[model samples]
Target: MSKIQKIKGFSDLFSPESTVHTLMENLARQVFGTYGCQEVRVPILEKTELFARSIGEETDVVQKEMYTFADRKGRSLTMRPEATAGVLRAFIESGQCGAEGTTKLFACGPMFRYERPQKGRLRQFHQLDVEVLGTDAPQADAEVVLMLWTFLTKLGLKNLGLELNSLGCPECRPVFHQRLRDFLATIDHTQLCEDCKRRAQTNPLRVLDCKVPACKSLVENAPSIAESLCPGCDEHFAQVRDILDSAKLPYRLNDRLVRGLDYYQRTTFEVVSGEIGAQTAVAGGGRYDGLIKQLGGPDLPGIGFACGMERLALLYGQAQIPAPDFYLAVLDSRALNTALLLAQRMRERGFSGEVSFEARSIKAQMRQANKLGVKTCLILGQDEMEKGQIVVKDMATGVQKNIGQDDLEQALGFRKP
Candidate 1:
């Protein structure tokens, strides 16, 4: 028989690392709630067409990265490569868009993609996603961006760089698309990467986001989206900027920062950290005004963002687990029941406690207690039980005291207020 191993690009989180993961999720829940966003759970798998339509069939996510397959019924299904499309699908199918108020939802879970995994990129990864539906106000865009910024900074990530851009809405984007196409026609097609070349024929805006050195150099002098924005889009972008500025948030205008999604329009932004090399974008999101309607929902606009949980764990470092309040050592086998009862009582009273189950020597039990880093230890043995008392030892100070069995609660200061 062969030993089983974890598949490539997938990993198991253990100990302190898992603890940090919980901390990250808990913090996100608390912070996202403060922004009036409620939790929404969506399935990991959905109809393959959901992504093909929302993420655009021409984009890299749908073209090459999605983990798509056929079900037993020969129906196409795909493990979601991102959260936004799945979220929108749920919103439309559940009729949340028909509700009166704007829907602010947040979700966190694993997203699967088939791309080659690298340092911060994984085939199976996690994201902290937030979305706001039924609003076209630029303030909604600014608020979502600010919340993402606040969430990252609160996680101890420092020196973040904020980049902002706007992809004109449908009315004006077509004109810019033609202008961009015209410019690409003048350049030698051989200089562009294969992916860039295909994107040029399908979605020209994506060419500006190409990471290839040659393709990047070619687009350096390409026309800017700012000049082609319709008056409505231009005003929306200005207002988003003004709001960000009013809040004293600093950001740079990056004309080349067209996010790798087809739904974004009007306002787009990314928060990056230099600590993570090329995958510096710790979080990114933008407005998707047509997604809700496109997905068979009411005509409503939406904005949202997603942060890579793996990259967050890498930069968050290891978090320290707090020490237990008490460690109960069974110095005698006869006292085992008493120690277990006392530990349970302590826990019920809101004090964390642990008990040793093995019939080890007193010295061995004490050594284990020290390793647990407990503040104090309750030593129970035949001798102490005979006196109707328990031995309480302060691990840090090495001080010992004898307390009546009934007085254990008082001695530990756990006697309810």
Candidate 2:
């Protein structure tokens, strides 16, 4: 038989690692809810054109990274390579933007991209996405940045730095793009990749995102859009920084940090961690004032950000590791029915418990309890059933108490624990 293996650049998220996923997502939901942001769930598959238009057709995500395929009906579709485009599409298609006048939305789900996997970068990843629509003020920009930092700090992420920049609005970007194109023209075309070479002619701003050593060298000296920001753009950037400062959040200016997508505009920033690996930017986002209009909706200004749930999970402390409160041990075949009844009753009483159907010995069941790291075990066997009593053992203290059926739930601390 041939060997079985996962697809290249993909991984299995199982067992304890899966617990981390739940923990991070729960914490993010709690934090998001506190800030008046409601949760949203979007589909994983979308029409290919949604991305082709929302994310730039010339960008890497559209040109190379997308997992696109034609369905049996001959309609082209793609898995969501990123969350922002799909979120925006949902906003326009649902008419939520029009009815609500503003939508403060948060979403957490898997995102797919066909790229080489590395330490923190994966072919399939999970992200916590936050988006706000119908707000153009600099206050909206700072609010999202401040909320992200607050959430990270609350999670005990230390020394997380904020890197900020503004790619300027539509009216002023063309002039700067011309200057950027002019600067790239002088560089040796032979040294750059075909994609970067093509980007030079089609969308020159994206060249800065290239990691190639020679290209990075050429682009390092290139003029930043920040320097050429029109008066309005400059004021807006300054105001955003001032708002962040007023909130007592520390940040550093990064002139060349334009996002990979074309929809992003003024006020881009990332919450970075040195501990997490090179793709350590746990969260990043920016304003997209024209995206709503571009997607065939009314002119609406929006800003948002997304954080990698997998990376955040890796950083959670020991306190976040959850343990089942109770383990229901069915000693042998005779006690199986009793164990099941007790476990179900415990659930109804708002307590958590797990039962094993393996028909293991008392010693083996106790070992499983210890391995699961739970404190209390409700041990049911023929002897205890014959006496109409159940033995509750404290795994940590090795203490045992025999309680009758009438007081079983109360004695086990089902309602309290």
Candidate 2 lDDT over 1-417, as tens digits, reads 999999887888875678777766788889888877888889999999989999989989999999999999999999998898888888888878777556789998989999888877788999999998898888888899988987888777786788999999888899889999999989998999888899999999989888787888878899988878889989998999999888888888888788889999888998878887777688899999989888888889999999987777666634445677789887768878887887888777777768877567888889889888888888887888889888889888999998986686677654653
> Which residue pairs overlap in candidate 2's backbone?
none
Which residue ranges in model 1 land beyond 4 Å of their true spot? 413-417
lDDT of each: 0.89, 0.85
In model 1, residue pairs whose N, Cα or C atoms come closer than 3 Å (at least 3 residues apart or on different chains), thus clashing, are: none
- Among all windows of ten consecutive residues in candidate 1, which has the lowest summed lDDT? 408-417
lDDT of 1 by residue, 16-129 (tens): 988988898999999999999989999999999999999998889999999899999999999999999999998888877779978899999999988787877889999999
Residue 156 alpha-carbon offset, candidate 2, angstroms = 2.1
